[model samples]
Target: MSLLLDTDNSAKPPVTTFGPDFPFDYDRWISHPAGLGRLPDDQLGQEVAVIGAGLAGIVAGHELMKLGFKPVIYESSRMGGRLRSEPFSGADGVFAELGGMRFPVSSTGLYHYIGQVGIETKPFPNPLDEATPSTLIDLESEQFYVEGAGHGALPPLLREVSEAWSGALEGGADFTALQDAVRKRDIPALKAIWNKLVPLWDERTFYDFVASSPSFAQKSFRHREVFGQVGFGTGGWDSDFPNSMLEILRVVVTAQDEGQRMMVGGAEQLPRRLWHLAPTTLAHWPAGTSLASLHAGAPRPGVTRIARDEAGGGIAITDRWGDTRRYKAAIVTCHSWLLTTHIDCDESLFSQKLWMALDRTRYMQSAKTFVMVDKPFWTERDETTGRYKMSMTLTDRITRGTYLFDNGPDKPSVICLSYSWMSDAMKVLPLDAERRVRLMLGALQKVYPGVDIASHIIGEPITVSWESDPNFLGAFKGALPGHYRYNRQMFCHFMQDSLPPAERGLFLAGDGVSFTPGWAEGAVQTALNTVWGVLHQFGGKTLAENPGPGDVFDAIAPVDLPA
Candidate 1:
């Protein structure tokens, strides 16, 4: 029989229940000194609770354990929210990233974590610098022009857009200006750049805003503009989305300035290794208990009540059956908007301004499609053209996005890979894998020639629509122009109204709070900085705020995503 620790000091009264899968292996858990089981429940005082088992929460819980703090993780779904990989049995038993692909060197902590876990990284393909001649097509004009490889492969209009974008940044137009303009509903600024800014929000439809723009209308060669928007909105003919053309453009430009890097085996390898690094911690971490309720009493300074059942010292929590347990301090890592919609938090507990800001921010649209081909068709070039390019940039005279990764880098004989971005338009499509593949292939045939892309031999495709995922409605929170300023302080002020300062002791971590705000590195940084922040609270260690979120978010290094 395992010894039970007292849980009397629980601020939030819990409705406890016990079942077959309740209490876990107490003996094994005892070996971990920093583990939850080792902490006397009376001293630990109900323990810190982390909701959402995604990387954000997982990493946060791990850091807490390292700091002699035990955290009970509550997840409504299986692990790895939007970061996942699919395994395909082929010649080399290869795998492909159906979710996230690469992380650059700029993510120093992420690289370190990968290295600490023995995950290997590989050099990204440098086709952009490979001197391969490729054709740059005007999607609107159907007028094709060829560039002799390298950085010059971009179409004339695209080159202009890039130059103009760079000029805008160099001229002191920062994210703050854009965000402020959006917040103030600065009609003039928005209207001045309405041609560029409206498309960022309106790119979900099949219509091509770039082609419709007065700028494109004046040009005799605007006919191909629809394809440009198709290319841009969809992250190119073959990409994945709900990410606007503007967002995709930002990624590309950032990649060009920052460069691309990836794990040699696959992206999943990193997280898988991290899970194994602290095997005892992950294997014994408590989960599977549904937070049946969030009982909110009268609000107190810096505190709120979040009640739960079938957790704590009860069942094993593997099969969804468990002993009901309770926790007081919980930091939810799921969608904030969803939190407001589904669960009730103390309205008086959250600041009125923060609540209003959260209400105004729209949900992000995210989807992924993975296509497996017998071979990388892009590498199989035209014998007549002698071009060995594996991918091309899909752009209108305006926006650009979409990418093809070589899933066969280690196994060329078996699986090939491609992805497309359709932004919010994917929401209207059937969410099945077949329809996704057809849509991707249909888009692909529209851009490349018959022998080049059309009628290309391929295998089955797998698509994951994150918006429909039970645990998460979207990939991440969309920080509108001014939301960053408004919500940036939410982390510090979230617990201002709670009692006993329970939340001050509880840590907050998530990409939504990060400078980058939407990428994997931002998620990692959230965890890293979270640990640093908590340690600072304990008078342990601290991080320099010199870079600041805005600078870090806009920081550009070299990237290898190709031009």
Candidate 2:
């Protein structure tokens, strides 16, 4: 967002998930407009192996390559990672956003790529956007439509639910104080407030906070149920019930779920563009060389093993095809569990404290199913039924949330038959796309008795169970109660000087290791953390006036690990 941009647009926000923002300026890191520091002549040709061609890996490689280092990226699958955009069998310019669909403006780090890449973004058909002119909230045989959240007056029950959540925040955490600190970017105040509450909330679940908070306690348990069923912003909070209260609070205070937009074509376009974008100021290589150009338009094979190169060399990586190469530095952007489960990583590569953090990180489950229709028939209003043909729906039925994507009135449109998480997702995990669509359509039939949804489906359905993907294992990290120390260890792993020589050149990054998982902001920011770290390892330095993150990390760093 422009909130962080300064008069000359050479600065960045002063808030970091790992702590208060770095004392140094971000503009110092980027000599070029894209944000990068120059590597010394001696460090120019150093090879930096980047594993996983996801956002974190891609961003790290893209930036490092700009700084004159050779960043060869490897991937087990496609380049976009969780930003998978699948199209119908015969349709063009139409797709099902299988993962990481909506993005909020608060995600300034990600917006940097989006803006530079020049991709068009439109309002996602969230609860309240131009895409969703109407929204239906259906439950217990009762149905109601609102213009959009906060657009018009809310129903009595929803009003009570909203007020109760507000009250709960006020009573439990002093919501206004924290929110003010967050918005004002008051690092000291935020640390002072958040540190005290972290220990208390680290041991508490979201449900525990809701149930025990004075606001919800005064009202019956029904208030909590109502809040879970239809929470403010996206939808239900129930899926996050098992996560630590700190997790939910971070999301809430940051408002990463609010006022978001979706890329017009597909969210993947940004990363894809970055891969092919030949920056004007690239060093060492030819002026026109891009990551795609350097890799010959294809990523290297997936990494299978990582070891400390024994002959006083840097790190050694072995890919799936049995090719082993040594690089000065390696950034593992793959999921954390992959380090232990799939990769043959040496135990000494990480401390037991770091290993515990990596191994115990919890991930959430998510599923989404989509189908293309002949047209946006939902825009039609039935004279007899007294309701628009269909609306962006939220329900308590088998299909929890259904979204409508209108390409145009006459063009093929997409409907997310069901976008469920946690238990709701697991319910349909066993079913194929067709069967899931059938079940979702059947469920929708119950909600809108006379509506004929199946007849409008013009093409095949697309579905995803992120948990089923071996590479991801689960959607994203959803830290459980008491996992704060693990998170702290993981988030701070970029400071390799604190580690022994055996683990020094290996860096950990990705949304998985970030403090705010499931958000691209975390991925982008953490990847930048590694870029700064790797640069420093190779004797790179930022301009003295605009120091980089690592230049003063110790002073500004937060998350003091527990003894």
Instruction: Estimate TM-scores for all models.
Output: 0.62, 0.94
In the predicted model 2, the residue pairs found to clash are 29-36, 30-36
Backbone collisions counted per model: 52, 2
Worst 10 residues of 2 by lDDT: 1-10
- After superposing candidate 1 on the true structure, give the runs of residues whose Cα lies further than 4 Å from its correct spot: 1-46, 89-93, 123-138, 141-150, 153-155, 174-257, 279-305, 308-324, 341-349, 393-402, 407-424, 452-459, 491-507, 532-563
lDDT agreement of model 2 with the native: 0.81
**How many residue pairs of model 2 clash at the backbone?**
2
Q: Estimate, for each residue in 1-563, the C-alpha lDDT of model 2 and write its tens digit.
A: 11111123234333323232222233224444544667889778788999998899989999999889989899998998998888789988999888888988767678778887898887788764555777888877688677644623567777777777777777777766776676566767877777778887888999999998876887877678877876777877899999999888887666676767899899888778999998877789888989998899999999899998998668899999999999989999999998998899999889998999899999888999999999999889878966787888888887889999999988999999899888999999999988998899889998888889988888778999999998998899999999988988887788888677887999988988887899987888789889989998888876665566777787567557467
Question: Relative to the true structure, how large is the alpha-carbon lDDT of every model?
Answer: 0.43, 0.81
